[model samples]
Target: MTRVDFMQGNIASAEGALAAGCRFFAGYPITPSSEVAEHMARRLPKVGGRFIQMEDEIASMAAVIGGAWTGVRSMTATSGPGFSLMMENIGYAAFTETPCVVVNIQRGGPSTGQPTLAAQGDMLQCRFGSHGDYSTIALAPSSVQEMFDLTVKSFNLADRFRAPAFLMADEIIGHLRERVEFPDTVECTPPRPIREGMLPFEPEEDLVPGFTPFGHGHRVHVTGLTHNEKGYPASTDPDLHERLVMRLIEKVERARHEIADYDIENPDAEVVFISYGVPTRSVRQALLDAPEGLYGHLNLRIVWPFPENLLKKFPNARVFLVPELNMGQMAREIVRHCDQPVISLPRLGGELHTPQYLLDRAEEYR
Candidate 1:
């Protein structure tokens, strides 16, 4: 029989990691996200997995990448400042096509603004946080249960695509406690397979070929440079580089349908509520309070590799309102893809959006 327990969102995330076959964890403890690390520290050992507290976030990220290369599913948890420190390694994971989960329980800041406060300010950073043209996969969970479910999905998607998957959360959700039920046996998908004795840079359809671990009898050369089939650094030929980059981009872009998650409520409603992370809870409440056929919503669980199809659903919505704990970052994306009037309801670190606030906005827009 399955059991249900009340747990903080961070703990739920860690439980999800364990369920997803994550056997290795490396991260420094930070506010809100520290509990995730703590849970892993205790739980992983019992499961015969490994857990290590690195000196900093950079090393933590590096260790997880190494663990992934060794054929172990791995993850790390950190907040905003630590996320900044892990940016370079995150890019490294991207270029190497290493599969790992990064849980960012977002706190305020450009640089440690509010360690205990919540913010969705890292939305843009998750997409452009690292310095590169590579594609990123990120998921935002609005509730504690989602924190659990999405963490497992993050690992599955990361292993499936051989890319880093992010669980973008905030302090409120990370620290909040809620009752969650678990299945009898957790199911985790197997990693994608690279061609036999495959060359690292060998291009295949959908842009991504299968993968082989280092020292696995494959002539695999991993680097952050533009390369060809042999994986050797090759940048002089413009055509070769263009083809290489496009393949990487297209792999995610082409698979956008398989990668995005958008829940629509009352498709014919005049007003649409757009939000992610913890702010989405408010949007849900607003939906509950709204009259039938009055309001619609798009709750984006997967932020990166943006759901182009979902946006097309309400391209000309009468009014689209995005509320985030930041200065209109995601709202800009909605505006960019949407051919409609997008309204901004920005908040900074400390304050969180409430159902009442959204109700007021719905009335104002109506």
Candidate 2:
């Protein structure tokens, strides 16, 4: 348990994963995110962990799913195009209830438009990338420090919910050089219990089912198809399918307060600024240096779960500015959660949102 200095965001992610007890990694070499794999390759073995560079991102995702079944906390990192290749396997991990982490350092998309550049285009993809009705937890980091902390949180969430947790970052957050303190004694959230002699799909008080490792002598049979409490395939029962889907959704949906991030800089302002990821850094900086009297800034680090309850407290706001890298992926969620009109400032594909651009937008709201 040692802390390092002068680390890139990707390296910090690797260090965080290791600190969270992640012992297995499988990924391809993709830009902005490849450094995560590289760092894990060098360090995983020293800690009695395993690292593999698969032929492609598909195989990489599959490997981690298998690793998780073996009772090892695992992860995989890739960019936009590589992330697409991992969708099918990601769905597999979800249905099987595999506990692992997926890191997507997003870049210009469609089909590798800009490999080396940063883009927040994967916001929607992380939510809808996998098929079927499944709950995926995606965490976005605005700074290098968050890159470390959220990576650890992502692993904990994955283990807790028995679902694949995503660390969705853009190139800026992945490549940014910053000093991040890595805690030697990392405090991680606890996952659902897999007590011996209990059914895997049995819901605890929180509505989340417990997960157990394969070959643990509990007779668990995990499958990508619909399954029952025993983990054996059970697609024939409609009730079983409905129970599984509802439980998966409720597991994360019910814990929004535990999962969501909301910061209120000015609690008494009429106007609020809403944004996530790297753009939030600019928004905060802009508000800090504003010409004395300006609007309040509500920066969100957790995009999913929407924080519906917390949003009900802001009814007096005249306008809410939703600034993101895409054409309002988060704006859609903001509009759904708020009664006021959400002004969307969308920067599509490989572009960064600047403070001046946001300040100009904020002025219009006034």
Candidate 3:
């Protein structure tokens, strides 16, 4: 039977990780996200799993990578500052194709801007912060229940792509309390092991190499430097490096359509609201107050890779209005894909746009 409870989002996310077979957690406490680590510390031991609170975010990220290579599903949670500290190692994880999950319950920041407040400021950073040309999977959860659902989905995507996956949430949803339904069992996709004769970094048809866990007698070599199929450093060779990097990108990019998760409402309307995360709630409210067929909504659950094809679903769209906690981060991406006029309704300093605010914005375009 499914279990239901009134839970906070961060706790639900931790429970989701546990259900998805996360046996290892290494994290440092940070505001609005600490509850995740707190829950993991309490719950992991009961399940015979391990939890470690590292000295810093850098150490936390490294520990998760080590745990992943040991054949255990690993995860970590943080907010803006900690997420920044993890960038270098995050790049290393991407280059080495380590499978792990990182949850960032975003708070406002250029540098510690608002620790206890809600903000979606990390949306672009999670995609490009690592300083490399590698692709990754990121999920955005709008509600407490989605916090559970998407965190489980993050683990599955991490294992499937052999790349770092992220849960990019915000303080609003992370701290909100709501009833969540827990599944009897969460589905997971175990990493494919390398065949005996195959090289460690060898790509299959999908461009993702089979995982060779440590202590498995596979004699696999892993490194952050550009490597060949045998996993030896080949950084000096131009073509080999290009091939390696391109495969890392294509593995996720080519699969965007298959990975995309979104909802389209009133597709034929001329005025559209493109949104994700907490702002999506405002969009929902606006739709309720508007005429039945007056506005279209594209609520994206998976934000990275941008799901550009979804734009075609609204052929009659004359204007696309995007309201987010950050100042025009995703709006720029939307502008690139559609010729329709894109208006950015940016909010910062930890406040969500009111439903009336969105409706007023849409009214102008109408």
Candidate 4:
């Protein structure tokens, strides 16, 4: 097989999922993200994998979780409105500790605001859109290569951590065509199997429980309610509820450092730019034009658990400038973590900030 090819980001993502040993795909076809599903439909069967077009995103998410319990790596792709629909079941996946990947090719939306245009409006949604207090693992890809690399990484993280993982790409990355160099073999980590005698949801030291594949004599009860280690509903017990909720959040948060993927440059510079996903493209261009040691940069690959510790790497930074596609969804997270003044450069519509646009804004403080 050719290891390098020019392909769209969505197709690269599907190839990544296939490369990661994802044998089952279930999703509703939505704009900007539909190509991922389309590609999977054609590719999965050739790989002896299965693909299903569900009634909607909710069912798509449910089917993914169900397929995962059968010991197969499962995934789904959707855009903003569809992403919103999946929130409920996504919570169920989190509460149940199901290892699966969700690709959200973000489009502008409060309610279908922009179907084809790109936006990072759903960054906060992926982290907190689902009902309540569970932490999530989300990866954002800036290029076609990363769309593949991060999709594979997302699956590894999901299996290693035993939680729902997200490939948080936007429409810009999804539809863009670029050269992607595939690895001869990508690293893989299957979900840790259940021990001889352990409850379904009982966690190990890492706060992640081993997975029990459904079928053949091993049976595990799975429920969305606050459950004990046995996977039975225990919503009535406040103590059990607290313990369960805390563990769900803590498993990812506790592993934040281990889960964090980012890049830092010119750590001693006075003016800094922190961004993830597509916005980082602009940051890179801005950096190239600036003088040596003129600006610091922090680009995140794994965003959720947010990686606030990366901020402290730039000690001399007087202002942390953030340019995002939405109205500063992540800027809010930055504000709480850093003492430095954070300037939120939010582009409300689908427009991306240009390199010149960012550099000009920095002149005041730079």
Q: Order candidates by TM-score, high to low.
A: 3, 4, 1, 2
lDDT by residue (tens digit), candidate 2, 1-366: 556587789988998999899999999999979999999999999999999999999999999999998888899999999999999998898777788999989887678688988888887777777887777888889888889999998988888888898898889999999988877778776565576566877777777677677777666777878888777788899998998888888887888877787677765566778877888888887787776547777777777766766665565678888788778887888788777888888887666778887778788777
Residue 299, candidate 4: how far off, in angstroms? Answer: 0.2
Candidate 2 local distance difference test against the native? 0.83
lDDT of 1 by residue, 28-123 (tens): 989879999999999999999999999999999999999998888999999999999999998888877788999999988878799999998888
TM-score between model 1 and native: 0.95
lDDT of 3: 0.94
The lDDT for every candidate, in the order shown, is 0.86, 0.83, 0.94, 0.92
> Which residue ranges in model 3 land beyond 4 Å of their true spot?
none
Return the TM-score for each candidate structure.
Answer: 0.95, 0.95, 0.99, 0.98
Model 2: residues with Cα > 4 Å off, grouped in runs? 1-4
Candidate 3, poorest ten consecutive residues by summed lDDT: 189-198
The TM-score of candidate 2 is 0.95
Candidate 4 C-alpha lDDT tens digits along 219-290? 788888788888887789999898889988998998888778999999999999999999999999999998
Better of 2 and 3 by lDDT: 3
Q: List the residue pairs that clash in candidate 3.
A: none
Highest-scoring model, TM-score: 3
lDDT of 1 at 87: 94
